[model samples]
Target: MNQIRPLIPLLVTAGILIGGNGLQGTFISLRALQEGFSPSVIGLVGTGYNLGFAIGCVYITRVIRSIGHIRAFSALAAIASAASISMVLLIDPFFWFLMRLIQGICFAGLFATVESWLNARVTNATRARTLSVYRFVDLGSVTLAQYLIPTVGIDGFQLFAIISMALTLSLVPISFADRSSPEPPDAVRFNVKTLWQISPLATVGCIVVGLTNSVFRSLGPVYAQGIGMSIAAIATFMSVGIFAGVVLQYPLGHYSDKLDRRKIILVATLGSLAAGVFIAFVAGDSTLLNYAGIFFFGAFAMPLYSLCSAHANDHAKEGQHALVSAGTLFFWSIGAVIGPLFASFMLDIFGPHALFIYMAAVLALFLAYTVQRMTVREGVPAEKRTMSFRNLLRTSTFFNKLATPPSEDKPENK
Candidate 1:
């Protein structure tokens, strides 16, 4: 039963993550369309979500650490459910922005609880498989969102509301069913600054991942619209990229596990660099080429965060995994907040190609930073190597969790 108990919570959490947050990326666009927001303003709204998400990650961990996983998990779910409804009821951009911030915080808290729960349950033997299962749920849920949006119509916030509610409700059973785990420690105390000092490449890698990911999510549609692609073309562009990333995770991860993990970074970064060039040179001219380009981009680009996390984990203290995970999330959210606003401005100034250009530039810097790490290149200890998990889980679900900050009522490290 203990073996299966882990499976239950894991599956339930996966369902909640996919059903809830996965729908949101497309849903925001649909809602923005209905609300008539300008591209720049739409980007700002996304920025607000990132700002809120960062706060949630830092604070929400503390909440779970202090309150016990069960209670904190329930509170987060309820908050998210209510926040989703509130955003629908209060449809004005200003009000929705406010609600999105609230939702960001709540969603972050819930995500932290679930991530912590997964870590708490599994021993070393199961960590890889657990991560794989989690990834599958993550991707499966989000991919479902692309299809769901057209079915419901972009203007139908109510259906999105139903989807959000269903996701939140899924958590209730998992929250109650799992025997209460011990609270997260008070100080999984590797200083963020210290961690950055140890692995500047990894630190900057998190930022890059955040920058490219949010930029794509917030502005991908804008590019499709500007290029005069059909709606199906737009969806295909986004979906195929996501699928390519999903398929690439295991092969890449296995390779990373077997070799110098940093080499994998170099390889992925270079591949992303090539994909960016493909985007810059050809995507604007042919929709099929654009689709193929973004697909390659996803294959190389999307896994950066997981790779960053794994790299950091390679150097982490035993109890520090959650802290490091959340920290990477914090940095990622920081990037996320800035990503869209910059991309939107560039889009307005230069047109759709700026989106690809923005992505290309970010990858260039990531490659440069990784190359700059001579010490890492020369003598990274074999035992300390960080092997990133297979991209099997859509771990982006955890990004929402990062939005929560340290809750005032709880300990700091949580």
Candidate 2:
């Protein structure tokens, strides 16, 4: 507790920043829908965020390195706050899409700055524990942020103002902190060919996850709204799914360490597929059925990225874990960019329920691929498994530093 005490301000900042971003995400979707934006345009707006995020992942480190963390964070926070309020000024889909793109880049830089600073504060002994606390912060903040939509009501400018305030307020704690800024994180590397060569299954798993999960995150509100759910119900629906993801991550990760990680990936993907099917065909307009289906859906689908990361690290050489982590995100971002656009088209053609059908189809294909990989190659020997399972957050490359297990050959600061 004493060791973590000094970092409390940063954690508070993280919570505020993450909460604001979370609210902004759901709000944008619902607002766009209310404005009578076509499903395709909504999807494009989501894609814009993902695309900008990927770009930031590749380049934001340089900004931190050049200007240092504190200034970079302040700038990013200001930009993010501006971007949040900018949406209310112009309700045009294209304008919102552009704002979302800017929001994405700013938030990406914000996360990279915060996470890398956290990494600097902890020693190897405290890394995992600190990460666990940070993950809890993330989970709690994002889940609670959903309720803000219902409380404020998404019709007017209040939600956007609240989001802007949250982002702006995040800067206060950090500005007053006693500690000096941490060193900048290493530049993100995307060694695609090498990552695929090391673990094709892990690569494919990330892409599959990106495709299916991004849809749910970006379009699930649309699904809920389309099904005649109220604003509060939509919040509950999204929150339940996210909460379920946090609940199931540890147990799934524990089992993956004992056996082949691919098996756990397969199990998670199958669960997501089943839940998707239940939501699409069985739930209909029954709120109870929808809630139950989303709970199961999130439980299985949310942990696949960590599972895949663990599997990939099992094959990675000593210092290659960072590269593997960055590469995994690269592929995932690729899928994320494409997923919403395609899913929106599906929603346009088939209606709200088709959202799950599209997700289920993707999961089914990934499930088959996982099975085939199992047949082709034997599981990693327990003695050879260099890394254990850690919940891989898609925040930044430096975030992966906490996720990497302490191996015999300590990785040098990349």
Candidate 3:
């Protein structure tokens, strides 16, 4: 506990970011639905933010390095706040895309800054626990945000304004925290192709993670509405599903830590595959079943990327954690850019149900490939696997700046 005292401000900052960010695109989706935008336009509206988010993650590190953490974060936060409010007023789809792009950049920059701070605060002693705590806070806040959106009533520009205010409020904790000074400026660097060489498994894992997770994040609510769930139900359904994942990540992480990380990835992919089939077939019109099945989905689906990330780190050369992390984010962005468009197009043609069809197929293929790999290569025995997430669960104080620096440029992780 003493070791993490300096991190309180960082944790609070995360709380605000997650809580606010957790709202994700609820306001946009809601308003678009209310305005009677076509399904495809709505998908684009949501996808636009993610597009920006990926771009922001890629470059925010450099922007921060050129200035400093506080200034960079402050700029991003202020801009995001303005953009959020502007979005509420500017209802045109094209303009929304522009706003979303800027908002994405700001959101990603804020996340990058926070992640870098978290990394700087850690040493070897408490790495896993810290990561667990930080991730829990993140996912927990996501669940809360999902729940909170229904209260905003989802019909007007008001919700967008609320998000704007929330983003502005986020600046307070970070700016006024009791911490004495910000860390020194950092120059960011990471190479995607290089990381791919170091760990192809991890690189592919990152892209797969991005593809599935962003699909749900961007389109789940829209999917719910298409399936005949109401607005409030959509909020609850989405939050519950996400909360299930939130609750399960620690156990899953612990379990993965004990085995060949690839095995854990394989299992998770299989679970997602099952969930996809269930949604496509068994989960017909029964909201309760949707909620329950979504819980299981979240359980297996949510943490796959983080698992891959940690796995990659385990095999990484010294000080490559951040570099690998950035590489992972790069692949993630690639997947994010592709997943929603493809899913949305399918929704446009085969129907909304096709969304899950695509998911099921993708995950199923991944599971097959992972299984084939394990069979061909020698792997650790199943019994030898053990992960300690159980002890690390529930009781969390928290804290990575996710930009990940490389050894050559920063001497951290290049």
How much lDDT does each candidate structure score?
0.68, 0.88, 0.71
Candidate 2 lDDT over residue span 41-64, tens digit each: 899999989988888888888899
List per-candidate RMSD values in Å.
Answer: 5.3, 1.4, 4.5
Q: Of 1 and 3, which scores higher on TM-score?
A: 3
Which portions of model 3 miss their true places by more than 4 Å?
A: 1-6, 121-133, 178-180, 380-414
Each prediction's TM-score versus the true structure: 0.84, 0.97, 0.87
Ranking of predictions according to TM-score: 2, 3, 1
Q: Report the C-alpha lDDT of model 1 over 332-398, residue by residue, as the tens digit.
A: 8888889988887887788778788888888888788787774545634655553335342323334
Off by over 4 Å in 1: 123-128, 179-190, 258-260, 313-323, 375-377, 381-414
Worst 10-residue stretch by lDDT in candidate 2? 405-414
**Cα shift from native, residue 218, model 1 (Å):** 2.5
Q: Which should have the higher TM-score, number 2 or number 3?
A: 2
lDDT of 3 by residue, 209-284 (tens): 7778778877787788888997789888878777777665666777776777787788888887898889878997
Q: Which candidate's lDDT is highest? A: 2
- When summed lDDT is taken over every stretch of 10 residues in candidate 3, the lowest stretch is 390-399
TM-score-superior candidate, 1 or 2: 2
